[model samples]
Target: MNNEVNGDGPDSCGIRILGETRDLTVVNNRIGNAPKGQQHIGILIGEKSDRIELRENELSGNLDRKIEDRREEKLWPVQIRR
Candidate 1:
């Protein structure tokens, strides 16, 4: 599946994960566009989220952030493997 979000505001992204999400896995996906002065985000992992796995995914050209994590945990709970 293809996910796309076009906005020039905060929290605008291809994928937005909020609240208490755990044990989530994203694999083999193409996210966002190649930056050409456009502000975009590949994914937004918000507060109270944990244990997210990103594997074999192509996230490119997000001028803002490829992965933005806003969790309040002491340690980052994202595992990325490519």
Candidate 2:
């Protein structure tokens, strides 16, 4: 699935949960490789949310690399909530 996700929600992001939710879990899957020129995100949990359980998932190669970029990414693979 190129930029497509199978989550239990109406608006389909890779996985976007909101509000005073807690204890999220992402497990057992290989999420990688964006169709050239795309920022393939493996996952994202909101900052307000807490106690994320990430286990036994093969997540790799989700990045957007290009030349002439001004702001260098301080973090590799991905960046999470501030």
Candidate 3:
């Protein structure tokens, strides 16, 4: 699937696909910023998903309140591969 978010305002996420039951592919997307008053993420991949690939995309400016969350642990201004 193709996911993209382009704006100055904060957004919850560019794409959030939870409980995906099949193989998935995410390519050429841009995710950034979190909502106001609440810390959110640019992209969130739940534990239920498997065989997922994130390629040729941009993720930045994620505001995560919870330091323990995985989204909070990232290398900003660059692509993170897992």
What local distance difference test score does each model get? Answer: 0.75, 0.43, 0.47
What's each prediction's TM-score?
Answer: 0.78, 0.49, 0.52
- Kindly provide the TM-score of model 1 when superposed on the true structure, using C-alpha atoms: 0.78
Point out the worst 10-residue segment of candidate 3 by lDDT: 65-74
Which residues of candidate 2, in runs, are more than 4 Å off?
Answer: 1-13, 64-82
Segments in model 1 whose C-alpha atoms lie over 4 Å from true places: 1-3, 34-39, 74-76
Number of clashes in every candidate structure? 1, 0, 0
The candidate, 2 or 3, that scores higher on TM-score is 3
Per-residue lDDT of 17-78 in model 3, one digit per residue for the tens? 56632366778765555444332555655545555566776665544521112332222222
* Cα lDDT tens digits for candidate 1, 1-82: 2344466675567778887888899999888765443446778888888889999988776447899888877365699999
Task: Give the C-alpha miss distance for residue 24 in model 1, angstroms.
Answer: 0.4
Query: On residues 1-82, what C-alpha lDDT tens digit does candidate 2 reach at each position?
Result: 3545444332223444455445566666656544433433445554355555556665555333211112233222222222
Which pairs in model 1 have colliding backbones?
35-61
Stretches off by above 4 angstroms in model 3 are 1-11, 34-39, 65-82
lDDT ranking, high to low = 1, 3, 2
